[model samples]
Target: MSETIRRHPEAATLMSYAAGTLCEPLAAVVTAHLSMCEDCRHEVEDLELIGAGLLGSLAPAVGPAIRIPKRPLECEALTDAPVVERRRPDHLPAPIAQVYGLGFDTIPWKRLGPGVWHHRLELSAGVEGDLRLLKIGPGREMPDHGHGGSELTLVLDGAYADETGEYRRGDLQDADEDVEHRPVADKIVGCVCLIASERPARFKSIVGKLLQPWTGM
Candidate 1:
């Protein structure tokens, strides 16, 4: 790997996730990574062990026997092979192979330009403005635009920047309508991001509508 984007090691995020301390978008990044990185999976298990140890030392407390659920396929799919690979939906980071593989490719990702493209993913059908993936491609830049809804992005393989700053893997960029951005990805290797948008793009024009279909806005 060229190492264009600096990945904040899974250790930090895993620990936070195990402790239930990370925010939603950030946790999603960690969960997305854990789907690929065995090291992080072990780290989360270690944290669970530590927690169990702590619980063992504590006095027994009364609580409901709630059935904690497991993510769809861990033991069979992810844990078996153990090596992360780039994804086809714009060759996402090795960690996000599951995310791309699960259902991203099935959706129609429309191109905005030579290098720019995106697709609107269904997070919750009932929710009017639900979280959706705004997939960006290598080295392309979005126009100077603002969000009418909230936007949360986790950098998977590459990185992007705006008037705010740069976002790398495991780096979460939370943007509100107040945020106006024109992000440019690295030209050579390009980048892929898992962007959950609360609102649609504010650039309402012929070109904007073309971009809108990809976002389902």
Candidate 2:
């Protein structure tokens, strides 16, 4: 199949993901993108194979005995958690669903502006980063911002465009401190995206700057 994704994560980023060295949230975003992108999926698979080959080349080392911990009886029943069937339009990619546990409608969205809403996701303890779902109304303009570190955004539905280019469903936009721009949703349908940020965004506009502290972006 032809490559559907226009923007892709860099080789170094993909390699870090394959090596399991990326932060949890960033890895989750890349995994979500990989689920919708065939070309990137194939590339990740190749990297995994290469990683396995390198591991096989290492000499076996004798390590200290590891003790297997027993799980408490109370935790046994907790494994049977309820799962909701995801609906259309807001159906999430597998990676995201695995981490989020709930569908789109179930997300608790906080109104960020007239046409923008966001749902901040809580990662497991010790995981560092900001991960969230952003839903923007049609013709809405996202806050103009620059990055403190790196940011990864994966479009789950509809489309949006920024100074770099247009991003549609299944597209991943990779931005870093070097990138700066405001993204606007398509006039007809708006957009919904999964975003993972290494650090808080630095807003450019006066209004955005005023709201940045409270928004945590």
Return the top candidate by TM-score: 2
Error of 2 at 53 (Å): 2.2
Candidate 2: which stretches are off by over 4 Å? 1-3, 57-86
The residue-by-residue lDDT of candidate 2 on 91-118, one tens digit each, is: 4775555444556667778999899999
What TM-score does each of the candidates earn? 0.54, 0.84
Clashing pairs in 1: 138-190, 149-199
Model 1's alpha-carbon lDDT is 0.55
Give the Å error, residue 209, model 2.
Answer: 1.6
The C-alpha stretches of model 1 lying farther than 4 A from their native spots are: 1-109, 130-138, 204-206
Worst 10 residues of 1 by lDDT: 61-70
Tens-digit lDDT string for candidate 1 (52-140) = 57778543321111111133444346455644332455344333344334333444566656776665433322434533345566667
Native RMSD of candidate 2 (Å): 6.1
Candidate 2 lands at a TM-score of 0.84
